[model samples]
Each structure stands twice: as structure tokens, then as C-alpha cells.
Target: MRSTFDFSPLFRSSVGFDRMLNALEAANRMAPAENWPPYDIVKSGEDDYRIVMAVAGFSEKELTITHEQNMLIVTSEKADEDEKQYLHRGIPSQAFERRFELADYVKVTAAKLVDGLLTIDLKREIPEEMKPHRIEITDETAPRQGNMHQIEAEAAA
Candidate 1:
């Protein structure tokens, strides 16, 4: 039993959450998630992550990883093989494409394929301006000469 959601009320009261709201609507509209080509996302460090995908029969040349803005795309295409009779077919050969939405400042650092597993490494490189810095607390009697704006104000006076 699935229930629908109405976001009109949120739109009326919210100010700057358009992107989050759109993501929610997109998720609601998407089909049930597929389980093929199992993958795992692990947080290896404070700002590092890894994605490991089991691609049993895919080669390094057959896989492609792309990073665009805050999105990571992984696609695979199996090489064409001669028509051969087989007793049983269990492995999936059809092409597939998967997308992962990454957070701001997150970037793909490296990717490798080994033992039928595709591993991707990611790191978050926050800009200096975005990082927090300590601001010294000064006593009321302390001179405010350290501020350039204050110096300029005094020069104007």
C-alpha cells in the first residue's frame, strides 16, 4: 500500500529548499529500485568514501565512470561475443547505467576495476572560505585597530 504526498504546503512556508523538495518528488516518481549489479557505499574516513560494485563479467574497458557537478554516473557495456550455444544463462549481459547523487564539495578521486569489482574513491575538498575559522573575542577596552574597516572609518573621520 503506497500513499501519495503533497508538497504544496511546504512550498507555501519554505524559502530555500527547492533542490531538496525536487529530489523528494523525483524519488517518489521513480520505480522500485533495482537490485542488479550489487554495490556498496562505505565511508572510509572523515571525508572519504568508497563505492564497490560487483560486476562479475565486466572488464575495465567495458565500464565507464563520469563525474558531473554533484552527480556520478557509472555505465557498462559488454563486448559482443560470437553466437554460441549455451546450456544455461545466469549472468546478466545487457548494458546498464547507474547514477549517484553526491553532496556539495564531494569529488571522485579515483576508480579501479579488479576481480570483477569496480571500486570508486571519493573525497570531500571543502573550500577555505566554506570552512569555519576562529574569531578572537576581545575585551571592551581592547583597541580595535586590527580591523581594516575600522581604520578606514577613522581615516574618513
Candidate 2:
């Protein structure tokens, strides 16, 4: 485990609870089950994402990707066959289980394995109400609009 600090000054802070910040901080603590298989995470778009893992010598049936309660779980296991024999075994047969903490609006969009890479895609949809709304301000209203009352009221509610 690693130690991280919260250096968020009170000046010019956000309005409500910082769930995304917490999620990002929590992400630093997440570690792979083992170092056997390396992986990569790529963001394709605002909501689209991809998680690619180097999975050599493992068939599609041997790998698994699942999402549970906003957490993405990946695991790979290969079975031993008596019919096959190997003169020298350089590749690893060990299994691995990795857990990734997904954001609030994030979801697994799709998953596919190709060319020894297990790719898992994700999507994030910001709720309609959660999206920012534009507030029109007139000359008169702009004079009295510098108060934090609205933010406080929203937090209280």
C-alpha cells in the first residue's frame, strides 16, 4: 500500500462531495492479484474506455471479465491436460485475479479477446440531472449572484 495526501484547499473548492476524487485516490491503492500478466487501460472517448491485458497461451474460455457493484474484476486460469506434453515450459501457467474500482457512472460496455490481448471496454454516462446547467444572469441579478447560499441550500437539501 502507498500513502497519498489530500491537498485540496478550501479556496475555490467544488460544490458537493468529491466522489471522483475519492475514486481516483482509491484507485491508487488497487493492485493486481499478481504480476504474472501485465495490462493496459486506454480511454477511447468521453465515456468509452478499454482495458487490455497481455494473455498469452490462454484461450478465450480460460479468461473471465466481470463487473459487480461498480468494480471490474478480471481473472484467467488455464487447465492442465494430460494429453499434451511439453519439452520446456517457458510460459507461465499461473492464474491471476485483478480488481479495478470503477467510477459512479462508469459501466462495462464490451469485452473481447484478440491476438493474445483481452480488451474490456467501459462507458460513463453522466445523468441528465447531474450534467451542468446554464443559468442566465441579467445585469441586476449578476450584482447579487456572488453568494454561496445556493450551494449551501443544495447541500442541505
Candidate 3:
């Protein structure tokens, strides 16, 4: 009987911020809250992302979008009715709650409900210091573009 160890790097780091690490680990281990509304995450551009949820039969008035901590939550609830009068209700028009994890600098740009889909745009604002930068090379150490020796040899030939 042999025992296996996790041996993950997360345990080897300094214990200064162990509480945050534990919270992150717990968040990652936990499954999604609910799957009541089908959604898609699409990368619109380099620093832009869009989350589209298929909320067919849900009205814009019933839906709510809110941000808590680093998570974006979208919840919806239908209006109360005295009597149910639906012969065939194929569309999913029930209460739903959806959550999305947002990056450090990501912010909600806009949200719109068109037809039956609810689209929420997110923009990641990267600081100038964090963005990738190109190093400028001086003429002295720059790599030669062509084979000058071969050109000289061809000229001699």
C-alpha cells in the first residue's frame, strides 16, 4: 500500500498569503453554482471579451447584472401570474443565476439584450508598464540582414 502525494507547487510557496491561496484553491475546487442559462464566452479582440447568455423568453426588465468582488453575476426572475396559461412552453423562462470570473483589470463595458440573447462586453485595461514592449536595438549590435560574405564571393566570382 503506497500513498500518493499531491506535490503541487502551491504548497511550497511562502505562507505569508496562505489565506488568499486557500480561498483561490477553494474557489477553483468548487463547481459552478448553477447551469440555468446556456452561455458563451467569446474573445472579441485583443483586450475585449464578450459573454453571451441564451436567455430566451427572459425580458430585459427581469434580468439583473451585478458585480461582486471579482465575479460578475446575472440573475433573472419572471413576473408573477394569477393562473398559468401555457399549452406549450418550449422556451426556458424560469429564474436563473449565472456567475463569471473577471480578470484583475477587466471591467464591464456594456450589456444589451437583443432578441433573446443577453450580451455583456468586458474590457481588460492593461497598464502601460504591464503591456509588452519592444526593445530598440542599436546599429552596432543589430543582426545583419543579408549574407555579405556570399554577396562578396559572388561578386568576385
- Considering every candidate listed, which one attains the maximal TM-score? 1
For candidate 1, the per-residue lDDT at 145 reads 75
TM-score against truth, every candidate: 0.80, 0.66, 0.66
lDDT of 3 by residue, 61-105 (tens): 899999876689999989886688889978777787887877667
Please give, for residues 16-117, the per-residue lDDT of candidate 2 as tens digits: 557666675665666634666888889898778888888888888998888997789888777876787789998877778878888788888888888988
**Candidate 1 vs 2: which has more lDDT:** 1
Candidate 1: where is the Cα deviation over 4 Å? 8-15, 134-157
Alpha carbon lDDT of each predicted model: 0.89, 0.79, 0.81
**Cα deviation in Å at residue 89, candidate 2?**
2.3
Model 1 per-residue lDDT tens digits across residues 10-78: 988999888778788888888887787889999999999999999989888899999999899999988
Error of 3 at 34 (Å): 3.6
Which pairs, if any, clash in model 1?
A: none
Residue 6 in model 3: lDDT? 47
Q: Where does the lowest 10-residue lDDT sum fall in candidate 1?
A: 148-157
